[model samples]
Target chain A: MSVRLAITALAIGLALVFPFIAPNDYYLSVMALVYVNALAALGLNLTAGYTGQLNLAHGGFVAIGAYTVGLLTVDYGTPFWIAFALSGVVAAGLGFFVGLLSLRLKGHYFAIFTLCVGSVITLLIEKWDSLTHGVVGVIGIPAPPGLGPIRFDTSIGQYYLVLAFLLLGLFVMRRIVDSLVGRTFVAIRNSEDLAEALGIDLMRNKILAFVISTFYAGVSGALYAGYVRFLGPDIAGVSRTFDLLSASVLGGLGTLTGPVVGTIIVAWLTQYLQFLQDYRMVVFGPLLILALILFPRGIVGSLELWAARRKAMAEPRAPQAAPLAGASENA
Target chain B: MVIFFQQVLNGLTVGSVYALVALGLTLVYGILHVPNFSHGALYMIGAYAAFFAVNSLGANYWLAMLAAAAVAAIMGVVSERLVFARLKDAPPMHDMIAAIALLLFFEAAVQAYWGAEFHRLAPPFPQIVRAFSLTAPAQRLLIIAAAFGLMLALHLFLNRTWIGSTIIATAQNRQGAALVGIDPAFVSTLTFAISGAIAGVAAVLFAPINLISPTMGDLVITKAFVIIILGGMGSVGGAILGGLIIGFAESFGAFYISTDYKDIIAFALLILILSLRPQGLFPQGAR
Candidate 1:
């Protein structure tokens, strides 16, 4: 097998074994939450980083995903397994609509338009007061039944479930990134005008990216709903969108680590900084400024640079041209 | 009829505040070509500065207002020097994200210092201004007057002042401005400082009608964004017009439509305009 394949399999292998090695329920919970966030971030990174689209409606899609699972399972008593899959499709549908609808608008228009979607969703959630528990939030949702009596509701069980979702998310993301579609996405990100000139259909690619990205978000939301068994209005908030955007950018947009690194760091930072409460945003202002100044490409992108440096030293005699970096794609 | 007029007047008060905030937002956008998301936070900072200045220093309201603007303007200068200056040549959107990050940091920092519990006026402004049968809150009228006065001053500055005209020249053509002996960096610093100061002044004007809080920036900024879009971005006239239209829509919509749905009106208007007239009511000379 190729070195890349070997690394990939090892990573997957670690995912399967890692839950069993957890230290405690808290750690497991944190890990599970991080994985779910990572999943969502990964999907968002595809659009924001690769397709060069900034989607502020991610949280809304996540809300749709979580709520879809909530309604389907609670109202109809559909099993978690089935509802989970359906929730993704539901989220993807909305994502697809956003992608196709806003495809023509560029930059601020797209961002603002998606923002409208999130705001409208929040409005609907508030207005529809009957279905959702409104501002009070929803509760009493049951845990998914065990895999043959495993009762994944336990801390360890959550780890496994989150692990499963993470694996699936990673696999799907990997496929999306490695496939021809991924190249097309990067091509579009690099230059839509150029890509279109090259005969690539812009609308179709954008719509597909939107759908796939939101599907992951929905799945993440569904998993979160299942875990927490409670949903609130804040799920669809502008701050929620900000959280997702920050995470995507934090881990190095367009790099694989964009999601994983961003999710873990933001989750940990937010959780630990909860005591800071209202003042948290103030500190974040300087940190974000610092992050851009220090590492414009983010943690993962910077890490890749370090690795490349190591590789350069290890192979001094090989006449080398540096591989293409993503700055050209940024504009 | 009084109640109807009251709400409309109330909205106008709020809309006037929005116009100031929108001016700050667009001035930066116009000159630097960077969407400064942190402008809203500057408004919040301005409020807090005034809040502290009044309570701790026992200053006059006007003095407090000037202090708040000065403090926020200083913060803007520091930010321009350290953060935005580095990003002057980066992609325009990168600067936007940086501004957003700065916005988040300030908000979180404020939250950490002061809990999320709402804060009312620190040093009270007079509540009543009886104008014949048209009874207006003294503070509300002040907000309207201050916003308009600032708008006039800003227009004059743009048209009359050497530096301000240079900044406008930069907006018209960065390359040409540089060719014609204008320093783009000086224009950027001026843009950011002016943007922050405008927002700071707006926050001082706003503190009377609205409670002061860190999260207070969010909804106000959304309205500002809407105004910027509607006003054919970068046009001061457009900002004022957009602000008034939204103020009335929100005012009348709240009365006629359900208040719950009122929030959607701006977003809906925004979407409609994008779909129908993407360039907006008064398109900038060359969008």
Candidate 2:
């Protein structure tokens, strides 16, 4: 626990000082984008990683959240904070209905169903031109309003604002994952039949997990609209969902820190490999397959496994003490 | 009335292609129980294969289609052996993710090789065909005829051939087939090859009517999924019927409603059907 805390402190410390050391506005902006993506990926992790429901419609929820904020602020002239909060609400509301309809589907059916749902969302956004601006997308989204004197017009200010939300998201996620409901989600993921046998209301709990996950996606999307000031139908594209999937899977699903680490690695790789251009997915696709085959546990999960194994090896002299070690490892 | 009949003709043409593609998807799903999301990539590759054969190799349309099927069959076998086969023991989610990755890889690879510009295949049967009050392109009629012909051949092969019986046996009971001395791996490979070939052939027949591009398979593949689900996951006959149903829906929906939202008809039907009867319109094993 102390080691984990120390690492967290060090990481946050680095994040705090990152803007100062970053090369330019581009890097700061990229980091801000990373935080937004991480928040979205974390939301995905709750349902996909821990709950075991592979949601292909996560990007759709993000789109919903983004559009919500975009329309409210741009069209309705709603305040940034109000629109931001409403983004999560609207996404969760949609997620609730989608979940009610889709949670009954198991495995591949569920995934395929969600994929269609996502396409429908994108289609609606694209064809509903009068409302969503069609393929041209929502533009000139207003900057987030300042708090007192802390103006957010600058990249640094926006970066900190996004970072604060990310922290809050992480804190909430930590609480959820550590709570009883989180355990129920894990239970459902492990075995729905077993969880049901234990008197868990499978539908209710699954919907809860899905709704919370979409809420994260929504807030993340709203943040994106604010920072980028541009919203397009492509934001809700299936590719975006795949991006989140890659982050969650590559970083290690079912792990709290995996999404952040995976998002950072993926986001940075994407930035650095811009020269590859169209060839990016050509490289990434195979890499993802290789990663899945080689390290199904993901980076963080594999590291934890390695550490646990090392600890066990070092204490092999005490055979009766193994259970205690295992318990602590779970903690 | 003529226009409605014309729309029906168009629907049948489109439905036949959907049936072909959905048939392939259903076969693989029946045998392996994996959705095979990369099946769309295979379709795209098939179109590209035929495009190269016609444009670069100077093959006729029929010959190009045969070449495409051959190429895609090999690709299907290779992907099954290289990617899906390796992850047989992992969770189903892994198979799906791997399929999605393969999809991304194939799409990007195609884009890299053949730029993103859309290419039009020369129509072999461009003449207009008129029957009574309805007039249509000979290519559309050919598409409908050729798709049905291919489907008939597939039906016969699955029903009459020993290898096809092995595929069916494996789909019904993998372990049982293995116990009966049938190699499940061979069945899997064969199923993938057949699926790939069907997708390839469908692409060749359909590509001339539409523009050929890397993402052309995107919408078709989703519609194929919708058909498979509507027809029931593993039922061959269900795929056929489901394909026709969706084809008619899109045809009428596009004409009656808005063309821009024609694609949504499939998805909307999918959600509605799944909500009402999650098991789909057909029972499993109704082949």
Candidate 3:
């Protein structure tokens, strides 16, 4: 408990000091984008990582969130805060429909269905030009109207704004992971049959996991729109879905910190390797394949395994004298 | 009436090609249980190969198609042996990610070699054909005939040949097939080769009608996926039916509904059918 608290404190402190530490607007903007992507990846981890659902419509949910904010603010002149909340709500509602689909389909079927849903979402965005402005995209999305004198028009302000949501998102995810609900999610992932045998309602839990994840994706999308000040169909493309998937898997699955760490590494690599823009995916594809084949557990997962292994080696003689070490050894 | 017939003709033509792709997908899914996301890229590669054969080698169209299929078959065998074979026992997600990786790698390779610009194959037989007051391009008929012919040949191969039966047994029960002395690795290699060859043929057929580009695989893959799901995984007849359904939906939806939502119709059908009949319309061993 003390260690977790210290880590949380350190994270908060670093995030608060990050904008000032960044060298320029470019660095700050990159950090903001990383936070945005991390939030979405965290949402994805809830379903794909924890509950054993492969959701290829994450970008679609993100799109729903972004477009909600874009349309509400641009067309109706609504406030950013209200639009943000509405974005999550609308996206959650859509996620419910998607959850219903997940009920029937399993494994690759569910994954493909989500891919189709994602394609349909992008197509709708392109065809519904009146609302989305078609391929022209919604430009000049208004920045958050500052609360009192604290203007968020600057990079530091936007960084802080995005960081606040990311931290809050992390806190919520952590709380969920610590709860019995999270245990049920893990139970479902490890073995649905066994979970069902234990009287867990598969449909309800699956839907809840999906909805919660989509909620996070939606909120992140709203934050993204506010930071970037634009929205487009690319937000819902298959590539974006793959990007989110890569981030989730690259960091570590089924861990709260995994998504954040993974997103940071992935975002950094993609941004810094701008020279490999054309061949980046060419490189990324093989790299991802190698990761899946070699380190299916991902960076954080490998670390966790290594830590566990080290602890086991250190305490082979201690046995059950230390309950925490003993329990993990059994696991 | 003429318009409806024309739409039907168009649907059948498109559906035939869809059937070929779906067959490849279904075969791989049936045996390997890997969704094989790279199948579309292989298809795209086949199209490019045929294009290269005609343009660079000055080969006839027929010879070009055979070359394309042969090239794709070899590539498939290599991929199965080097990458996919190692992933057989891993979690399904691992295979899926690897396949997506392969998809990206293949797409980039095609782009690097062929450039990003779209290429169109000139129709070898450019004459117009008419039947029952419905006129269409000869290329469309060629596509339909070729697709159906390939499918029939595949059906015979699977049902009649000794090796084909061995492939079916492996798909049904891997452990059982292994116990019965069927070499699982050999079956895997052969399955991939055949699947890749089918995709190659579809690509050759598709290239003349549609613009061929690296990114062309994206749309083709999604459509083939829908067909396999609608048809029922591992069901040959189901693939044909599903392809036809998609083809008709796309054609009629474009004409009757908004052209913008044609793709959506196929997806809507997929979701609806999957919800009501998860096993699909023509589940294997049932019909």
The window of 10 residues in a row where model 2 chain B has the poorest summed lDDT is B278-287
In candidate 1, stretches whose alpha carbon ends up further than 4 angstroms from where it belongs are A1-6, A75-78, A147-150, A268-285, A305-331, B1-4, B122-132, B285-287
- Report the error of model 3 at residue A6, Å: 5.2
Give TM per candidate.
0.92, 0.97, 0.95
Here the TM-score of candidate 3's chain B is 0.96
Poorly placed runs, candidate 3 (over 4 Å): A1-12, A316-331, B283-287
Pick by DockQ: 1 or 2, better one: 2
RMSD (Cα, Å) for all candidates, in order, is 2.9, 2.1, 2.4
Please give, for residues A261-290, the per-residue lDDT of candidate 1 as tens digits. Answer: 787887788778887665666656577667
How does chain B score by TM in each prediction?
Answer: 0.93, 0.97, 0.96
- Report the alpha-carbon TM-score of model 1 versus the true structure: 0.92
Q: Under the 3 Å rule for N, CA and C atoms, how many clashes does model 3 have?
A: 0
lDDT of 1: 0.80
Off by over 4 Å in 2: A315-331, B285-287
Report the C-alpha lDDT of model 2 over A1-331, residue by residue, as the tens digit.
Answer: 6888999999999999999999899999989999999999999999989999999999999999999999999988999989998999999999999999999888788999999999999999999999999998888899999989999989999999999999999999999999999999999988899999999999999999999999999999999999999999999988889889998889999999999999999988998889889779998998999999999889998988887788678765676787887775553
Residue lDDT tens for model 3, A1-331: 4765897799789888987787888988998999998999999999999998888889999999999999899888999889988999999999998888765677888888888888888989998898889899988789988989888888888998899899889889989988999999999988888999999999999999999999999998999999999988989988887888887788888778888988898888988788867567887887887787788889988887787677667765665557876665443
The window of 10 residues in a row where model 2 chain A has the poorest summed lDDT is: A322-331
List the candidates ranked by DockQ, beginning with the highest.
Answer: 2, 3, 1
A best-first ranking of the candidates according to their lDDT comes to 2, 3, 1
